[model samples]
Target: MRARDLVTDFPTVALDTPVHEAARLLAAQRLPGLIVVDERGLPSTILPGTQVLRLAVPSYCQEDPALARVVDEEHADRFLRSLDGRTVREALPRKPRELPVTDPDATMLEIAALMARTHSPLVAVVDHGRLLGAVTLQVLLDQAVGT
Candidate 1:
């Protein structure tokens, strides 16, 4: 299958998208990650769910896993409040990397290779610098396994 055939209408977020809103989108959709788009609506980066979770966690807990167990469930549940007033751009990794993007006509193998190499959950299918849609890892695996 080509990227065009595999592409689905996945969610996209802008740099200024609210962290709380983004987190809700991820949770509601149960997505592995979100594609961050630029002003021109081109894929800019992949914001993995783990990265969003990282924002909810306190640095102290991250530095010492043991500390997480000490916090009460009520307090722990409130961790997501840390994301309040933040934005997607602030949640992005400090280091920038190439976006996992593929051409609409690209072969499934090519798309798979790109995803594998980048360890990305989704691949943006662009046609001549314009955003088309995305091929998610789950969709790719389902096709491969004939499920």
Candidate 2:
């Protein structure tokens, strides 16, 4: 199947958006992640739920002193880890070394190769220089292991 077949055309967030807002969006939609975008309409990075969780802890600690140190240190550590040596353009991956990408006509086999090589959960699907959506490995496995 084509990447577009399982791709999710969801809303994106900007880098400057408050961590709280980003977390709300993910929770409201029950989504795993959001595509973080730059002003030029190009994706900058992928902000996954884990990033939101870390951000939330600090904000939540505001009302409870007990949680303050927890977020400030533990969760703060996670945020730093999420951005570990990452440039503004790096797509977050289970494996951050190589990027997984495909064109409009890429077949399942082509994506599988890239996924194996990059250990990517999601592969960016582009059409004529524009990002359409991402084909995630989880989606493929879900279909293959359908109930």
- The lDDT leader among the candidates is 1
**TM per prediction:** 0.94, 0.59
Against the reference, the lDDT scores of all candidates come to 0.91, 0.63
Residue 10 displacement in candidate 1 (angstroms): 1.5
Residue pair clashes in candidate 1: none
Cα TM-score of candidate 1: 0.94
* Candidate 1, position 21, lDDT: 96
Q: Model 1, poorest ten-residue lDDT window?
A: 93-102
Q: What is the per-residue lDDT of model 2 for residues 1-147, given as tens digits with 9 covering 90 to 100?
A: 777776667677776665556656777977666767778766666666765554434445546767756555556565434434333233333444554557867777787788777554567777776879877777767765773
